[model samples]
Target: MLMGEFWGLGVRFRVSAMENCWDFLQWLGPDASTCVFASLDDPSDLVRASAVSRSWRRFVIANGFSRSLCRRICPEVSNFTRAVEVSSSAMNQEVGSSTAVEWESLVREHRIYSYLCRCLVSPEGSSDCIDRCIGASSTDNFPDESIENTLEPSDRVYMRPSYWSSGGEADPQVPESLIYRLGSDLCVVNEIKIQPFKAFFQHGDPIYSVKFVRFRMGNSKLPLRSENYVTDENEGQAAADDNFVWTYISPEFPMLQESVLQSFKLPRPVLCIGGVVKIELLGRVQKQAMDGLYYICVSHVQVLGRPLSPKLALDTSEASGASVLKYFPVDSSSVAPNGASRDDEAREPSRWHAFAATLRHLRAGGAWNQAILNTLLRPVQFAEEDDDSDEEEPYA
Candidate 1:
């Protein structure tokens, strides 16, 4: 029988199933291939789309699915074994209204599922379940440039160490003075450990408090955390409990005020986790009074923890400068040579290579930490400059 005839025989997608499928297609519309391309912006959600059925999965693979999408989607799919049953009635170029709805629903469901999976599976959230899904590959050798490009920047950003701190006592194991540069001043941000349930600090679980302070240049002000915080009441919850103990440090009055040298306060400092904390640096600022370089300062920070508050909550801050800096596009020049391929044409160093090098050092020993730290502080000064310098290259 012709494809249309099959549907006329009452062999239609289940009503509920049809609805779900159409919802997905609405998000993608007629050309699923381009919709899939749009999904590349979010690797994790794209993966969820791949798990719906054989047709969808095949489409993802054929389109060169991103590694992060592969990682984020495969595990979250409800049943990898189930074959997606296409509706014969909808096979004709002209799809029925009901069938169209079903197709859109199917794609929507896939995207949502993929996003939820990433939120729960990321290391900053639930690490255990995700670890089992992608085993030894977690620690496998760093892939070459081509493979590295397959991984998304969102996945690679977590591979580096940004900040560390912890507290259950007067002073935590982490340093008392955190040195972060802002403009011309090398601001020495002070760290004071405050525990939940303590008399002066007692208010809420996941202790949340807010302090407002003036943004004086010479003044060393430590802002108060918000009045709302996390507490023991939120410990075992599946999602973040704002009531659970969390902290915030601000240098502005309303607690949400923007300042020149701002920093975030975390519920606990993470040291044993052994990964870098990455920050999104926006080079634009709103206040005209601030200096040109003021945008380089830390805008906000969050601490990602599981159960209660697994990820750091960041406050929005306007960066300094009138014009925002454009992101440097990844090009052939950014591809660095591998250990065995060092003799190849000089390639520009990739951010991924720097990230991989840091992971490598972490696997080695303590000295590696210092090495990675120095590299992060001054990536431009690395000796590997000669080996991967893309400056003279015509393509660069």
Candidate 2:
């Protein structure tokens, strides 16, 4: 009788174990698959999960798992799906079947958005200097001061003393504008830093400080090859300002009244298709002693972003045609009697006077013309020049 009882107990245990296994399988249905995938953070992991089995791939594609992951990573790309759908539909009418077109479009969006997400989250593998500043603009600049000076990197208190300034006039309502052109047609701007200049030599307090600053990204009506600078004809006029139509406007940020570098990060990554950024100094809190007018000054300005390259290697042959204005400061002590660097006596002019003479030489060859010079000298304006009806292409 004891032996019979042991056999019955063994049978009961086996049945129970089988039932438990069955129950666990039931728990892993479509709903459970979704729940598991939803918990995953990486889009690449989700793609790998889809390849595990036919059922998982179906679940990922049917429920749009990749798309959901993209939305979660970059909420700003919410419209990407609708835009892709429209584009896919238009393409479907051309050749492929509707189902194939839809599938292809979904895959494309997942790939593009996934790449963008990686760019935002991943550590920067390398840092290559992207020369995008085609030109610069300012509202008012002091004589002997150049906006190009702000692009240089320095450790001095006044990195580049040659700064753009609002004229010696106090008007809180009139804001100063500084515009920078991205040499490329489009770039992904990540960060911008501005260092306000302080006149330590002043008596009562440091004058020419910026109190408030804002930013705007927009498209330019002019061709990309054209120099992006204010001309003498449009100086202090609204027409120059009208040339650029702002697409994305940033919120106003308060600036510290010191010479320290201030950084402003975009709320989210922005696709700056317009290839131009305009920095607007809304409040001038200090006045200059010599001029007795309100002035805002900046020692340096920097734009940190990635340039888009379709090809593996960028063709820079055309880049020569693009006018790039850069300044290199010369150490007076290193100069030889004949005005050359110690190492290379055949070096180009390092002094301001010699540099100006070289610019004149370049201008004579029609390489640097009046428009380019005016852009370097005057402030950009904001008025409509002509009634040419050219509309910007919609973002895809």
The TM-score leader among the candidates is: 2
lDDT per residue, candidate 1, 1-396, as tens digits?
542342233223423456666533344454865554444545433444554555555455444444334333432122122212122222362455986766554543343333333433345521210000000111112221111221122212334322111111221111111111111111112221211111112232121112322211111122112111111111111112221121122232323223222333432222111011112221122111222111111212222233211111111112421111111112222333322112122222335344554453353445556655655534232233322322211010
Report the Cα lDDT for residue 105, model 2: 57
lDDT tens per residue, model 2, 1-396:
343353344345445756665432134677765676676667556555555444545566667766576567644334221322122133444367888766765555544444444544545532212232333344464233445445545323122244555565567556777777653334567777888876655686484666778887755555443233333222222225677656567888888887777888877666454457888887778867676677777767777776432210111113333211111122323223332111111211223322442443354446777777655534322231222333221111
lDDT of each: 0.26, 0.51
> What is the alpha-carbon lDDT for the whole of candidate 2?
0.51
Q: Which ten residues in a row have the lowest lDDT in candidate 2?
A: 309-318
**Candidate 2 regions with alpha-carbon error over 4 angstroms:** 1-41, 62-68, 75-96, 125-138, 155-160, 183-186, 200-207, 230-248, 311-396
* Alpha-carbon deviation at 300 in model 2, angstroms: 0.8
Which portions of model 1 show Cα errors greater than 4 Å?
Answer: 1-32, 36-48, 64-274, 277-396
